[model samples]
Target chain A: MGRTSDAREKILGAAHSLIELRGYSALGVAEICRTAGVPKGSFYYFFESKEALALAVIDDQWATQRSDWTRVLKSDAQPLQRLRQLFEETEAEQLAGQQNCGTVSGCLFGNLTLEMSNQTEAVRTRLQEIFDAQVDMVDTVITEALARGEVTVSDTRAAARSVVAQLEGQVLFAKLYNNASQLGALWTNCLALLGADSPHVPTAA
Target chain B: MGRTSDAREKILGAAHSLIELRGYSALGVAEICRTAGVPKGSFYYFFESKEALALAVIDDQWATQRSDWTRVLKSDAQPLQRLRQLFEETEAEQLAGQQNCGTVSGCLFGNLTLEMSNQTEAVRTRLQEIFDAQVDMVDTVITEALARGEVTVSDTRAAARSVVAQLEGQVLFAKLYNNASQLGALWTNCLALLGADSPHVPTAA
Candidate 1:
């Protein structure tokens, strides 16, 4: 049982990095098995198919990201400051990815969503749930900001969508431009969207 | 000469539809040749390789999209109104795609950027060029808006990036949710980003 679980994790980790770097359609089961150093039969034993493995990858990546989000968002910082910290951490993460891979990999969810959303219903719906959850988290933060007079906005939901969408777009630009500095504007534009009066300097990790 | 040009155009047209619907990695040369009704030899005769054909697709699709952008942006409409028209037109296009394929295909450039940016230099640089052109066009419109007092922004270039980024993100969401209506807020958020005073209804086509 221990080895079985270990093999499953190895396979998932391999798929995650491959998909992160090269995208969904380009990588196949054979490469994934070879990368994980697991037998092909073991892969089928763990996952019904490649699509199933991808769904698990999405679920696992989201769980990992959600933990980080919950930590930053639940901190005692002010709502606007919390938002800034979130983006700053994102920048740091992208820089780390660049250090490892020579270019920023952007968001796994955003990358997978764009590549597979139209091609597969299961992946698309799963990604929608992830994004919806993200919006909910952001909406909660925005509502708190409104209560504390940290920001002003007529519609919190639309504002949340804008914040999330802007971040995704910035990451996409970062990937396209191969420049992590392009992501610097995410926090400022986010503050402007939320009607924050004063800009906060990005906190270094 | 005429027959050679026709074969090249036919191959490009087939690739355009396939890549737009499926993506770059999933579609292969043989399928494209079959779809174009051209011989394998003919495909290579016109283009150097699959990557070259994809480059042509990017160039061709951008040419198609830029024409629409120019028509809307260069009209007699006010700057803010023109921007709204652009997003409205984008929404209509996504809806049309959804009607055809039961899913929003999003921006072809964006989709390709996420999938192939890390894998291939030619495609990544081509997409970056396309995005730069788009930002330039938006910057010009924003400059006009600034001159006319229709909008106020400190940095028009950053503002243009924000506009372009927000639209890309919204289309991504539309694709993720498989609901074109998710893109409805693009114009409103864009107006807010530009510091425009009020929302402009999308102009009739």
Candidate 2:
């Protein structure tokens, strides 16, 4: 049982890394098996197919990400400040290992939306729900801030969508330019949109 | 010579359509030939390989898009109104298509950025230049609005990036949801950010 679980984790981890770097279409089962250091036969033992493996990777990543973000959103800090901290932490994660972490490879969810949304309804619906959840989280933060008079916006949903959009756009730009600094600019602009000062300062760690 | 040129254009047109629908990686050369109604052998006669064909498609699309955007930006209309018109036109084009347009397919440049930006400096630099040009154009429009006191913002660059980011994000969302209506909401929210109203209304062709 222990060995089976370990092999499953290894496959998921390898798929995450490969998809992040090379994208979904470019990743192959052989590459996943080789990277996981597992036998090809073991791959099918864990996953029904390559598409199944990709779905697993998506679910794993989204689950962890949702928890991490939910914790930040529910923190004791002020709503606006908490949001800033969330982006800051994301930046820190991207910078970890000298890599631009903040979904700069583009949201694995967003990437799947573009690639598989039309071809596969299962992938499409799953991605849309994930994105809708993300947008909802941002809307909650924005609404809380609005109710507290911490921020002022005529429309909360639009503001939330704008925030998500900017973040998504920055990730796309960062992936294209290979520079995380553009993300900093995006963060600053987003703050300004909310009528707040830029809270993101590059940290040494 | 004219026949050869016609074949080349047909091939490019078909490739563009395929890439927009399915993306570059999923698109096969033989499929492009079939769509173009050209012999499979003729595909190699015009292009050395898929990569070469892709490059040609990118260049052609970029040129046409640049011209289309430039026409809207340079029109003798109110700067802010011109910007609104740009989005309106884009939304219309997206609505007209059966699937999300190229820019929403994540921008051919952005899609390539994810797939090849890390692997090839030549493609990376070229894509960066393309994006930068887009930013510069938006900057010009925003700067003009600022100069005319049409919009209120302390940082024009941030405003410009925010606008572009929202557009890119809307593209992704529209693609994911398979609904262009989200784009209308996005545009409405963006116009609100600029203290304007949504200009998109039902119109006849």
By lDDT, the best candidate is: 1
Model 2: per-residue Cα lDDT over A1-205, one tens digit each: 9998998999999998887776677677888889999998999998997778878888998999899999998888888877877777766555562354433465677666666666666777788778888879988988888788766566677677767766777777766766566666555555545644333431110
Best by DockQ: 1
Q: Name the TM-score of chain A in model 2.
A: 0.86
lDDT of 1 by residue, A1-205 (tens): 9999999999999999999989989989989999999998899999998899999999999999999999998889988888989999999999888989998898999999888887788888899899998999998999999898877777788789889998999999999988888888888688667766563432110
**On a 0 to 100 scale, what is the lDDT of residue A62 in model 1?**
94
Which runs of model 2 end up more than 4 angstroms from their true locations? Answer: A97-104, A195-205, B99-106, B186-205
Judging by TM-score against the true structure, name the best candidate. 1
Per-model RMSD to reference? 3.3, 4.7
Model 1 lDDT tens row, B2-69:
99899899999999888878889999899999999989899889998899999999999999999999
Q: Give the DockQ of candidate 2.
A: 0.36
How high a TM-score does candidate 1 get? 0.94
The DockQ figures for the candidates are: 0.45, 0.36
